[model samples]
Target: MRNSMHHQAGFSLIARVLHWLMALMVITMLFVGAGMVATVSERHAWLLQLHKPLGITILLLVIVRIGVRWAHGTPPLPSDLPLWQRLAAKLSHLALYALMLAMPLIGWTMESAGGYPVILFDGVTLPALVEASPGLYSTLRFMHTWLAYTLFLIVQLHLAAALFHVLVRRDSVMPSMSTGPLPGAKRSKG
Candidate 1:
């Protein structure tokens, strides 16, 4: 029997690199974010300071990833996959990107409300998005934290779906993401 599984021309090398890099950054942010909330001390302050820079870096990388995705179309899903699964796949990805964008802005807004200068790696400082206010600071901080939990759940779902595709379906969904090619899909030469 001919394999219905087609390898999609997966993401380019640039996209793969950016994907892994952003993955690392996001994972680190999750840990750092949790630590920042859980602890109250000199260590917490140091970690909290790392949050802004890391968030901004992810923001910039995400922008680039979006651009690259647009420039180069993504590979098609496996033919055997049901329509509902395809739709869910698309929506899940959309949610991931939305959360990726939202988290950083939420952090920035919270910091702006807290009345602190957003220092970059060192020496560099970012202008405040808005004037500092006690009420807004508290509100944004709460939003950032709650949305983080939501993002966490969504990420777990995403991972589970990928594993499902790989193990049960024996599809290329997971590999397409990891290596940028699905079964029977052509690799982009560009």
Candidate 2:
């Protein structure tokens, strides 16, 4: 028999790993992005190089994450949730997934418009997608900034909800994502 006591219907091991890993990367990217916005010195040049590749990596990870989530459904919300609350949860998650995928593409397009090389770590580089156009760069940069701000707000909401589930509601939702499945989540037989 499967260890029903141990696993929650939260996420697969691969999914969980990628989820948290991407979370860490996103947070780091946010900090680096803030630094890039403020600093204009040789010291910050390395961050500029790191930013593009890091974003591209996050984009790839999000693609994998979406695939995993599609293959294995997300754990259902707590039964006590109202219909609207549940709907909000679903919408919030969808928004997060969308932004996670979109931000990098916008950043890439912005970089491409600026005629910058999409250099990865260890000297690998991607081809430029477009000639430098100050107009397109400005527009894309604005979109990327706004989208990131929206992502930041949504993430704050997501984190607050997670904390509420763990601390106030004392529900399994937190544990499902934090560790594994809840105590009573059923395992799907493939």
Provide the TM-score for each candidate, comma-separated: 0.87, 0.88
RMSD of each: 4.7, 4.4
lDDT of 2 by residue, 84-139 (tens): 87878888988999999999988988888977777777678777767889899999
Point to the candidate with the largest TM-score: 2
The residue pairs in collision within model 2 are: 8-181, 8-182
Model 2 clash tally, residue pairs: 2
Q: Which stretches of model 2 miss by more than 4 angstroms?
A: 1-8, 41-43, 185-190
Error of 2 at 35 (Å): 1.2
Estimate the lDDT of model 2.
Answer: 0.81
lDDT of 1 by residue, 1-190 (tens): 1112322456668878888888789888988998987988887989988988999999888888888877765666766779998888788888889989889988887888899888976888888988999899999989889888888887888879878988898766667668667546564222
